[model samples]
Target: MSEISNNFLYEAIDEDIASGKVKADEIHTRFPPEPNGYLHIGHCKAMIIDFGTARKYGGKCNLRMDDTNPAKEDTEYVDAIKEDIKWLGFDWEDRFYYGSDYFEKDYELAVGLIKKGLAYVCELTPEQFRTPEYAGNTTTPAVSPWRDRPIEESLDLFERMKNGEFPEGKYTLRAKIDLASGNFCMRDPVIYRIKYVEHHRQGTKWCIFPMYDFAHPIQDALEGITHSLCSLEYVIHRPLYNWVIENVDLDYKPCPPRQIEFARLNMTHTVMSKRYLRALVENGVVDGWDDPRMPTLCGLRRRGYTAASILDFIERIGVSTSNSLVDIRLLESCIREELNMKAARRICVQKPLKVVIDNYPEDKVEYFSVSNNPNDPEAGTREVPFTRELYIDAEDFAEVPPPKFFRMKPDGEVRLMGAYIVKCVSIEKNEDGSVKEIHCTADLEAGNGNPLDGRKIKGTIHWLSAKYAEDTTLVLYSHLFTLENVADIPEGKTYEDYMDPNSALRIEGAKIEPALANAEAGERFQFVRSGYFVKDTKNPNTFNRIVSLKDGFKA
Candidate 1:
């Protein structure tokens, strides 16, 4: 496990404790995500901070669903969020909650603000409100004809709105804060709006929903969150959050939750936007949310990333107040480093080419001992079958070898991993001019040892007995987008313009050894000289390449 470095986020908490503003043990944080889509890699950073801080201070963090808007929210997303968090090794204990759970209190607070003359029901259409006449300038305040509606009238209209008496755009409840404040979020932002969509949890019992800006702070305070950690995009809304905390008369809680902002995670070659991801799924550009190519947590998990590796990546990147694009290779390197030490070794021949040992007995089958993981002695060893006919990756052989190529060539000698050295003596070509079979003579005296003459063999390759190999599918993945950073797409170009057409390549009928047929879904293994792969949970006889064997990232 990577240790958490001392960053400004922790420094702020330290200062709070030093100043007696908040006790170290009183630290409380919340990860409130809108359960409208699957959680992606960007959410992982926030999740770490939320849970890591609580663990650091012996405090508690709550997992709350910011499901104020019911349009896209669903119990499916809610369940997925919890599963992803737990899979990442964080525990919320008994602190799971939903924003809609506070809907009644949100309503009561809005009404209280109206009676206090700090809020009113507005009738301006969204478009009209955005017009220059209503969108106040620095000198001119925003104009709202209903800004001064009587408290009783606003209260009655709010109740009627809740009763489904009005259309979606007919009315909105807005806080009567400054209309010309430098921070526009305080320009009487909408506290509540009419949504006819059925809430995933609340059902049709309520027709109006609270906007996130209004509902979030209240939810934080109600949950007794001492630190409301969120991405840097919400920094501008800090004033509004503080304003709500000061004005709202939630007497039950004496201390208001403090809002802290940190930069969100952005990675090269992939996007974290839920809208873009949803479009990818909807347009059939990708398989689904858990498609190994997507950046969603489930997607990464399916792609064979471990929770510890992800946490290690997060620790290496650390927390930053400024936004920057991190190299995806850094993440790949973490998984590679982890799998190199942990994943068991297996033989898989993608694009198999037959190698017939002409000198070996046709009825004989020999087993050679091979280490399951060379880096892990306790992982033990497994026996691999070697027979008269074997399958090696077609790429390992080249009839006309390129310079510096050390694999198989005509009349060349190569060592079959865990077995004897074989010399390619003859080849048979198919009608398509491709090598159909390579007839090789195995040195029987070499056996599982080496050549008796001590002649060096330049090439070594992995192979599986053709008779014992199981046909399986292998899904190879690459960058989803060709662009280094999808965020830098040209002004008029959409992400689709940079989407890689061959992001995922599926190879069917790939030959895997009999040992691999017993691999359970999600079990990871290193394909000798190929890459790391994991069995697909939703597919039969299929594996997904987690990452290639090499990356330039040093850490």
Candidate 2:
């Protein structure tokens, strides 16, 4: 766990330590995510920073569930978020917390604000409350009519709000910051909104919930977090994050936690919003959160991405200040680098074309030794069964060959991967004039490493013997969206308009090596000429395409 790059945030941390505003070995942080949906890759950057920063400074980081909004919160999301964080190698130990757990204390904090007259209950409708107005050539917030309500009346209403006597949105507690302030968040932002929905953790004890901007800072300081780390989108909310911590009566030891922002991950070809992601699932545009084409962590994991590879990606794309779009190819490149060294080599022919070794082996069967991984010596070799009938990829052969095409055609000579050189004799056609099968003769003198025939074989193709092959399903995946930055859609059209209709394709009756029959979940392999693949956890004898072999990223 090397320290994250020394950027503006870390520089600020340095100053905090040098000036003694922050003590030595006290740089605590937290990865506080709302329990709403599955964590996406963008969340990984936050995970790396919070956990990595704490480890760097000899401090601790807490894992907190910001389960304030009871309407959409669920224990399932909490569990999934924890699983994703743990999978990235962060352990919060005993510091797991939820913002709703502080409901009583938050109410008491509001009580203190009410006593100091720093906060008041408001009855403004959302339109009236958030309406923008111009005053003296400057943007001004429309002040709530209830802003000047008597202190006792506001306190009683807030108490009543807690007792579930008020309908949702009938009342809310607003921090009494300046309405004329330039920052919109400081314009008497609502900190507590009435929500009648049941909380995943808190149950029916409380009807009012804390806003994220209000609850997060309180949770951070309560946990004694030194640096409140978050994405750059919260830069505007940082002022409010500080405001809550400053005004709230707390027992924090050193000082209130400091909020720092860095650029959030934005990438091409995928949408990050939970609303849209859920739509994709509900609309059946995607299978679920774990669909190989999805950008969710579970989806990536199921798509054969390794935890180490994801961490490596975080390292490759260091933390920064300004938000920018990163090419998704970089992500694919990172996983490719990892699987290139770790994934074992195997042979599987999709869209199989029948090949018969006409002259040499009509009734004979032989085993040819193939290297498990040419890049890894310790991987050794495995015996590949060779029989009279075998299946190669249809794409590896050409009825009317393209320019300089070196693979099998009429009278064309090519190597049979790790086996022997083969020369195509003739082809058989179907009613549609498509080549249904190919006839070839294996050159017995051109066996593996013992080639007596001196003619050079330029192209080599992978194949599986029909006698020993296993029927498998091959899943091919493409980008989920057809356009980059799916967030910026054509005005009137929905996100489904840009979705790639053929993102996930299933091809049954694929030919794979018999050894793959015993492969367990998460076992990865390179399908010879094809891309890396992993066995699907939910479907037996099915493999999900992890990534294509195209290395799009520059070294």
Candidate 3:
């Protein structure tokens, strides 16, 4: 929605509607997710495309839960998914659905398939079915001995299976496709399995659950979905998808819903696998699903990533069929661009070093005016306390100046941002030989527009009045993985092997200007030259650095 250019996905939808392949009234789409885990960034990309496409075409989008595996599915995940979708600025508007809601209809459809001799009851256990000897090549699918059973017996067994007559995994309803088809999915894939576990949504209403391949196409058709878009992995499954629709007798066109595949989003330095992410949580490697290092939407939100920024990121990435690893810097760039125009400018020193103005009166305190945002004049300005004692970043003062370092050093003169120019006179060292503090003398005569102030200083540094500055905590976050291509690790090593141990650093004893004392949670600001940061919701006083200001001079 933020001034995005035309892409193939949009062009295809437009062409379809213009060519009468799809009518405006029939342009419904749905984002079908399995409610087994938290939605990640990859899922976010799909949701934006799914809902964005529908909305642009004056169609409605449905949020459907593919709650087929009750053992791993739960209402917690269902609720989280909905909350995330809403947070991403999308709404399904009462078009919410669940695959479990069609249990009765799915059962009847399975029964019809049995009556048509296109499906049968297979007694093979999962272990035996997975064996190399049992699972032959696509040219020679190992025939199931039970496939020859009569339709009446198959139908009866399927009913008994649903009624809990047999234990879980004893029998399964499989499509009676070719035994020697080129496509492996067409070689008698499993359509239904007997699972005695209670469903999160339906409770104990049914024991037989439809597989994704069996339920997805039917649900799309039932919801009148015109564009059944999915990732490229489903390309091989399309034949079977159409087979089910064609075989099922329906009042409307059986194959009106078409499935299209696009390459999924993959980013460098981050693992998108939900299973691995869950392992990180379960093993205590990270805090939880919302850990700042995670790629989950909740994690991004907690890390001060605005929904608008994420939407902008998705827009920049666009839709593509070819796969590529997007640099994480691009995401950071998008966030920086958004925050620069919106976030207020403030001052906070992560590592504080005491600076004493020797010549200034110790009891005196004055207010220095500073602009809230230089980009917008109407943003106004606020006054910050200036006193004899102040705290500057420890790195700002170099005991021995490095080459090209323009910051404070012995005998160096610098402007104390918004205050008078000061020249360092001497350094005080502790017993440990560490520079404890730096003493400077402010040139009071060189006030604003003074004749002597015509001279320029190469360095200008931000500081907070030591007397009025508040002590607070600050969190600095970095990339989760050390390596760019986490998936390309050594054979035995996993993506976790490349996890960065210093991805998050919590710093205490940080000092902020008195103006930031009233900063509330969810408020974002550019912390002077430090970086763009936001107040943590969990701890209002604590600020988390989102991204640093770009240093164009850096190679």
Candidate 4:
């Protein structure tokens, strides 16, 4: 069970079951996606509702592929979609389905519609269908020349269309709805078309395919889906969805499916359209769908987002009818909250400055016990080696300290985190006027227990021994786009126009504590005073900073 309370969608399902509106054994749902592109963050919300709702009711949820359009579908996308759903911690088990598998049944249904005068073969070109003057308004429809064709002739032509007798777009099977109906979709929408192209799955089996509108409801009904949830865009198609089910004759089916629409997830600073995201990949705007900057599920997983964190985010956002943009900060906050309690702590310095303890013995080295997680005592501690020579963040030291600076400065004192307090006495400068090395004297008694006693430090900073620190690579990722609302761009300019040029920055050399030397890929850690980072699976030696520590000092 989820830690958060159930939202309205779940509440509705619970009520339906309690009132006997939905049978306990028939409350099945499905996540039907077209296998044409990778799943993005927007898809995550729908996935949660589809799978999560079913689990709550002890019902089954199917992961169905709406592969009606073969031109854009591919096995690559199918595999990626499966992998993404698994990563999100949802399983369809053996309930996987594909609309292409019902091609024959769909075609037969189209023929039946034609013979019953419910559908007809249309010869109208695409241009004539969309022309403003010829296209009718709410009260009228531009009649097709082929609407009055004889039923037997239409059925024979439809069979020939399926057998590859006609070229692509030369003929179509359209429903014979009210020509003067208020809803334009009721004005005889297209049911099937000739495409001559080979399908990825069915490959050359048939040239004609059923349209989404005509195929989806039947597919849902055949699979015993009780509720078909979709985005608000499908609300208008509800009438057509039911119309097809009512017109078609099914053999002993329990009940027809019901569809409910909700607003799609709209995220700030990100574009959800697959076409726009594809443009980013094809035009070199991003490396690929898995680029850490992208909103794709794979990208978020690679960038260190956890399944629990994503679910928590979805719950926090909740389900609503009104559309609004969710702030990216809310998503980051969920990650931070989850990591704060689980991710181990380590020390890493992006820009290193050498610090030498002058009074300490050159060959002497000791280990300090540091807590793995300060919030959880049972997590225990690990020993970190401390030597005479060490490395600290370059920004932690200043030759001439500012008014409020409390870190390492000449004649000033600061404590090395989990170690002894040290007073900086002098510094070595390079010919280029950059600080080469900082010299400090340690207060032994101030650390554990020694001769020199009772000293306090105003500031503390993290460090790594020069001999134990490992040189590693680091990658920093930022927002993909610079604009807050990518969909609201200027006319003529695309959402990609707002893509951030500096979304990813690669660092060749970074100093990390010995603890991270053996860290495996996909491991997450919070570098003390630095940020939360994750080991990159694609590049084992590389680590990506998910987000920096919140510094109240910075605006």
Candidate 5:
């Protein structure tokens, strides 16, 4: 059995179970995502609460698609949502469902309210009703001209609206809850609206659709959900959610789903709004919703983040009722720590500078033993090829050495990582003064150990044998947006204004160890001194840098 969570959400559930309000074995939750766009990190938290809480109690959680608004809903997003949830180690079992599955029931519940004199058909459009003449203030309640329409007339007009009788937005069915209440949602809110669009699943079977606040509760109650866990934004809407449950007649009466609010996950350096994300895709600022720089789950996965690292980050953050911004570096640290112990080590030269071991036999080749992962004793070691000609990262060498620089310098000694200690003898340069070939003589007898003369070598640099290296592509990524929090963009500035143009950099013809050539797509590796990377699933011989080896987060 899973351990019990000490968070407020679980505490409340514990209280409910203690009071017999909810049977411990009957604890049920759900993750209902609208099928419009890809799931972002924000959704991951909700998934954890819904599925994790259920797991804690050995209960069940449903994966329901809140595909209420069909304007942009598609099976494409639906499939992606399921894949993402499953990738995060969650399973809804046999309880998969769509919001449209209860459309007929939603319509029936609205009609039931009309017959009971608790609802009426409103003729005002949203624009007209939101005006001062109709919208009420703290001292006054909003007025609806059709609030008192006869129940019989309302029943007929609602039926006609559903039968495609009126054009879109010409009529609506609103609940007659309160006209002078402080809560605007209870002030004769429209429960249903007319939309002349085809539903992704329902087709054109109906024209009028129930709004989210109205449909969500009904779906929850019907599904026998005991706890409705949602983001903190819905705390104010809880009143309307309960009002719907109390007024509308339903079969699952004794135990309606209790709504609990928790803070949403807000991360630094990225925007989670679907509208802004769509604009980025439509405007060609990003490759797509799955762009590595995007915060979408698929984007993170493609960028080399494993489910374990993301869950670890979430666990460290814990659950809170108040809103806060999390530094992206915390997320980077999690992946770095996991990959350091798990990912196999490899050699990659981003900007290759040729090196020729002059004293090494030209016709001879040797192999050096290197640990696949130094932190894992069971990982064992692999043999790395060493030849007369090799390539090292250009940054590792300095024609002019910087202060305290331990790497290669003029006539300086450095170890060709996992091989022999070598000292630079001469360098060949191009016309522009760029390094072409660095000539060195290796201490063949040292063999990846201290020099026989007891000379100390501080620099150890990764290198790939020229004959055994393969050309590959490397894509480096940075923050998607320049701003730390796109949620609070400066006034008069759009999210697009903060888009970082250099978020992703692609380098071609980078050299990697030949063994890396056999790595399948999605395989992860640590490139020695560089960051962890994954072979791009869509591109052959290409790797995307996941996170740098450095951890900027202090904690």
Candidate 6:
């Protein structure tokens, strides 16, 4: 928190508090997400700001479900959202609310607008009033035909609409704001629309539902949210937001909520839209919303990302009003930074090749001392079992060495990490000409720094004793898309056209050190030379690579 030096939202709030527009000790904020889909990585940014800002000011934040359109909402999403927020370490206390909880208040406010002649029933169809009025800041005003409907008649219609008298789309209550204004949102925007569909929470009790623009301000006003933080797309809607608060008669709040906009997080290789993500799930392009390749919070969590790591990423990105694309590597850097300190060091040869120590007695088994975490002396050490036969990654050997290639070629010497230096004697091949086994002889006294072991082995590799290794699987993940921005595809080609074919690569029967056989679910480890990985929650003996040991994405 001390590292964050400049934030416009905080600056704005300080000025508001100074001006006495907001109470010094009563500062409140809210995260009003519609219960339509699972919260993604982008929503994490908003959550931190809304929850963090209130916390910073020694106040509270509310978790409000702005569920006006129940057509797309469900209790499933509501529960999931709450879980996600709590998982990220934020609390709303007893301030949890739904927009429908204030339906009575919203309806009364709408009636007040009607009584003031500020709102009227609109008879024009969505098509008739669908003029591109907001485009280029100069669209001709296309007023609704029922703009001047008599107060008595419109009030009766509105009441009947609430009583389920009108069918869907027969009439809409629109705010009678400027018709010729440059901003189309202020140009008589619809405040309420009649929908016969059943609400997830309200059921069939409400046939006429308040639009988002109408419900949001009322919700904020009722909750006394001093600062309404949102993404930059809501910047143009600020005036409309204030207009609703100004026109509505509400006594819950002495001051309207201050609307502040900041840039949203956008990454290079992932799409942030729920609709697109849903398509991927429904089409079986990905396993589910929690698929590791997905950018959703659940997906990242399942992919072995720590909550602290995500928070670190958010802090590094900072908050701004200007939109920009963040390099995905920074996100990876967050994971790498956090995991390096805690993830225990282990030896796991992903693609194992049998290496037999021909000079060692077959009945002998030795345990070697290795530091668990070199940076933390208190972490101490553990003994890894070593046997006459062991397994190393197949890539560590080359039958015909390339120029300057060092690791275990025939008759080449190398150091076995945490064990003795060994010299390869011969290579065995299969009928298909593939190398089957590597035969080696270890310098027995080398690991203890004996005088006979004086050598600089440039090729040091990790290994696991075949006898003490557990048969495991490693599930590696790559970017979901091949293109830098899926939106940059050629004409007629959809975002799925760039779906990465190698997004997930699974290796079976991989050998992991026996000590990890019972590693708890969600436990993380650094596969010595490979990467950071976590034990899969659903699949036993299966692990998911959180990230490579180093950054691979440059741009």
Give the candidate number with the greatest TM-score.
Answer: 5
TM-score of each: 0.97, 0.97, 0.96, 0.95, 0.98, 0.96
Best by lDDT: 1
Q: Give the TM-score of candidate 1.
A: 0.97
Query: Which lDDT tens digits does candidate 2 get at residues 1-555?
Result: 445676677788889999988875888999888788899898888888989888888888898888888888899999999899888888999988888778888888888998899999998866655445321114545467777888999999999998889888799899998877888788888989887777777778888888888888888878888998888889999888888888888978676799999999888998888888888788887879888888899989999898888888878888898988888888889989888987899999999999998976578889988889889999999999999999999999997899999999889988898888889999889999999899998888657654574667788899999899999999999898898877778889877788777888899999999889899998999989999999998888899998987775684
Runs in model 5 deviating more than 4 A are 1-4
Instruction: Go through the candidates in order and give each one's C-alpha lDDT.
Output: 0.91, 0.85, 0.86, 0.85, 0.90, 0.86
**RMSD of candidate 1 to the true fold?**
1.5
List ranges where model 1 is wrong by over 4 Å. 1-3, 252-254
Q: After superposition, how far is residue 535 of candidate 4 from its true place, in Å?
A: 0.2
Supply candidate 3's per-residue lDDT for 91. 93
Which tens-of-lDDT digit does each residue in 197-237 have in candidate 4?
78999999979989999999989888988888888888789
Can you give the lDDT of residue 191 in candidate 2? 87
How much is 62 displaced in model 2, in angstroms?
0.3
TM-score of 2: 0.97
Please give the clash total of every predicted structure, in order.
Answer: 0, 0, 0, 0, 0, 0
Candidate 2: list runs displaced more than 4 Å.
1-3, 132-137, 450-453
Q: Distance (Å) between predicted and true CA of 36, model 3?
A: 1.7
Clashes of 1: 0
Worst 10 residues of 6 by lDDT: 130-139
Q: Could you tell me the lDDT of residue 450 within candidate 5?
A: 83
Regions of candidate 4 where Cα sits further than 4 Å from its true position: 1-6, 11-21, 138-140, 448-455, 551-555
Q: How much is the lDDT of residue 460 in candidate 3?
A: 84
Per-residue C-alpha lDDT of model 6 across residues 280-392, encoded as one tens digit per residue: 98999988888999998889988999888888888989999898888888999988988888888888898999999998889999999988888678888899988999999
